[model samples]
Target: MRAKLFILIFVCCAAALLFPSMPGTDSLKTVFRLTDEPNEVIVRGMSGSALTINISFGDEEVEQLIRELQAPYPLLLLDMEWAERYPEIVQLIKKRNIPTGLLGHAGMNYEQNLPLLNEQLEKYEDFFGTKPLWFRTSDEQFPYTLRNALWDIEVNALGSSVRWHTGEPPPVIEGEIISLPHHREQRITLTDFRKLTETRKNKSLEDVLFNMSIKTKKMPE
Candidate 1:
């Protein structure tokens, strides 16, 4: 009995030393929240530094310009309003197999349009044959109420900022959502965005998109 007890204690000690629990004893639930706070949380968890550029120009000329530049970038947050007007452009992007995110306007709150939003999201999933990795509300305003609706759907919210230069630094909220400043020329090519995943070997697919917005750039107006 004495020998058995000694062996048990040794085993326990070894286990504790090898695998310690996190500092906070609380269980971490991975629910997606559609708030700026959640966005901040996701950004904090991103390990490798990545870059993101917002292609906000609605003019086809500008898009053509972008394509002409053809810099190796991974993700593009296409303006939904613009894409709605020219859905064919979105289809073109899809054909490229480039990951694209839709950016909504300030008044497009998830709370006001929960049913529609849910339906649209479902349709998006169906249309893409794969769920979108990133979704943003109000390119200018942050939608705080959207959190409740999206928490269950596993879709994260992207934060908005008025001024790129004077925004708060990204915070560690959780690993599901992230917020970023809105700078016109802040740019990322499809190649750089993919490179981000290379550095974060342990992160899930959702986590990569959640944190993508954290790396924003300031462009000259």
Candidate 2:
């Protein structure tokens, strides 16, 4: 009886080692969850010597727009819906050779957002002559289905280290990605922002991502 019990225990242990229980559907679904925070890989790829500033632009006032465009080599996050109505501004951005990414709206479910996102993506490609590598939603949460679709195409859903609202001054911290969203009543200026971090190096989105060795669909000309 003791010999038989030992054999049974050995077989059970071997079976458990060889064939683990499958993960439940819920566990699998968690793999597709979207986050509004930078992943470890992104944080690790950042430069320890510089701060990366991301400025969100869309239908901003002329003075504010100019200030943002002139800020220290920021990654301009433009809204596609606004871009559709303002081609001249888009052309100006192209001429200036600023590094840019897409900014989107949230709140809709997957079904409603999918078509809108597709249209925006098409417009972006048409405007920039290359596929975008990054996207950010106005709201923190992005729909899981759209996130999955973006992942399939290798587009990174970016999250910032600090999000600068209008009234407050843009803070400077090395090795951080600061997102400056638009507010019509924004009071800060380029001079004010520069005064804080003028000593540190400034880099574009592409600059940091290149450090990670990510391959895009095509390099934007």
Which candidate should be chosen as best, given lDDT against the real structure? 2
Candidate lDDT (C-alpha), each: 0.43, 0.53
Query: TM-scores across all candidates?
Result: 0.47, 0.61
Regions more than 4 Å wrong, model 1:
1-41, 44-48, 54-57, 65-74, 140-144, 160-221
How accurate locally is residue 77 in candidate 2, as Cα lDDT from 0 to 100?
A: 67
Q: Write the per-residue lDDT of candidate 1 for residues 39-104, one digit (tens) a residue.
A: 231232334322333455545554563454332333455554455666676677766545555555
lDDT of 1: 0.43
Per-residue lDDT, model 1, residue 82, is: 55
Which residue window of length 10 is worst by lDDT in model 2?
24-33
Residue 59 CA error for candidate 1 (Å)? 3.4
Report how far off residue 80 is in candidate 2 (Å).
1.4
Highest TM-score: which candidate?
2
